[model samples]
Target: MPPRERDTARTRRTVLDAAARTVAKQGAGVSLDVIAREAGVSKSGLLHHFRSRDQLLLALAQDQVDTFAAEVRAAVDPADHAAGRLVRAYVKAIFDSLGDDTAISEHLLLSAALSTVPGVAEILQRDARQWEAAFTSDGLHPDRVLIITKAADGASLATLYEGGSNPAALERTRELLLSMTRGEGSFTG
Candidate 1:
């Protein structure tokens, strides 16, 4: 009988998904053996897909950033004409990820741990350039964009330790940020 063919794409997806779950629960320093075990593959198999631990972490980080960026881009409303449309989209994406009642919310928790990996920083910085250009050219004042985005970031941080966010508070903050983005609110009375 012939040997079974390896499903490269499915295998890579499984490995990345398992890595995300393990890394979220344990941290980036977790052993590749552990990831392989979680992934139901041998360490050799995992190494075959990723040359080294850092390489795997780098791929995971890039995937995380790219996924979040896509979420933000999708949230953008082309007809809204809001002052901070991009920032609004960003704020919406952050809240949406935190609000997810599904397994995918693990990505947010995983992201908090990904920063512990050395190669992850470069991934984030490189991705930040795209956001920088979008928000800088976005119709809102730079100060407004900065505050709205930072507030959303701080709120999203709650997911790091809590594994999720307070729904009511998160919704309220989401609305407030959206309003601020639309020039309908202010930080001061």
Candidate 2:
């Protein structure tokens, strides 16, 4: 990439990171001035990248979704069966995120975004529908898929709220979820 483009990308990333931390710490009502200060940019500079507060919030939501999707794709294996790969990838992604400090911070940011942004919930719902369709198309039962998805989400949320979880329990849960994808175990909860 050109130096100009790299700088632009870096500026945008820095602004978004600052916005996420601000939102997570100060709630969704955090001011643009605060974010600008946090990002070490002037208000006009922040505006150059995001036209308005709503725009910035929307971008934050989309960025979080995109980042999580990339993580899931990275965890998927080409050699696995399509259904198993999808299920395992989803489970692995959740586990990976739970263990990541950045992911925990982002999760808090996401929560703030959902609560503050008008259309953010729709965006997430659309993403969830897409994942559901992909899993069903890959031959997994939709019910089972939803179960596993909700379980992972719930566990991740719990960990976020509680600061952390027992490592052994988390590992056991990961193994159980993976086994479900392989059709070797059932989810009791």
Candidate 3:
């Protein structure tokens, strides 16, 4: 790409990152002026990228999903051709994000913080449908897939509520969920 285009893309990313950080810190009620300030871009410059606050929020919502999906993709176990490969990777992504670091971790927590805003839920639901299909077809039983995903989700939510994650509890939950995906234990346990 050309330098100008690359600069444009970089500026867009900067704005999105700033918006996520701002929303995560200040909630959805935060103003565009603040977001632009946080991004180090003028209001006009931010508008050139996002157009409107809702547009920026919607873009942020999509960015959040994309970031987590990228994280899961990165964690995929290429050596494992059996079932639970995608799911185990997903489980890893969730637990990995609980550490309160990494850009991906911040997005996971930011997404939870933005869950109630308009457009965010629909974006999540759409992404979720795709994930559900992928999980169900990965050679795992439907029950195992559901149970494992929900458990990982609950762990993420617990991190949101608790303002951080408990390493020991997350470890235990992570162990149980990964085991279930691999068909090593009962889901009822």
* TM-score for candidate 2, residues paired by index: 0.89
Model 2: per-residue lDDT, tens digit, 82-165? 566788998998888677656676676657655667888888888888787778776666667777778877777655576776
RMSD of 2: 2.5
Candidate 3 error regions (>4 Å): 101-109, 160-164, 186-189
Q: Which ranges in model 1 have alpha carbons more than 4 Å from their true place?
A: 1-6, 100-109, 159-164, 186-189
What TM-score does each of the candidates earn? 0.82, 0.89, 0.87
Instruction: Supply the global lDDT for candidate 1.
Output: 0.82
Better of 1 and 3 by TM-score: 3
Sort all candidates by TM-score, best to worst.
2, 3, 1
Model 1 earns a TM-score of 0.82
Model 3 over residues 107-188: C-alpha lDDT tens digits? 6557667887888889989999999888877988888888788888788666457666778888999998888878897654
Ten consecutive residues with minimal summed lDDT in candidate 2?
A: 180-189
lDDT of 1 at 96: 76
Model 1 per-residue lDDT tens digits across residues 145-165: 888888988886665556667
Predicted structure 3: lDDT = 0.85
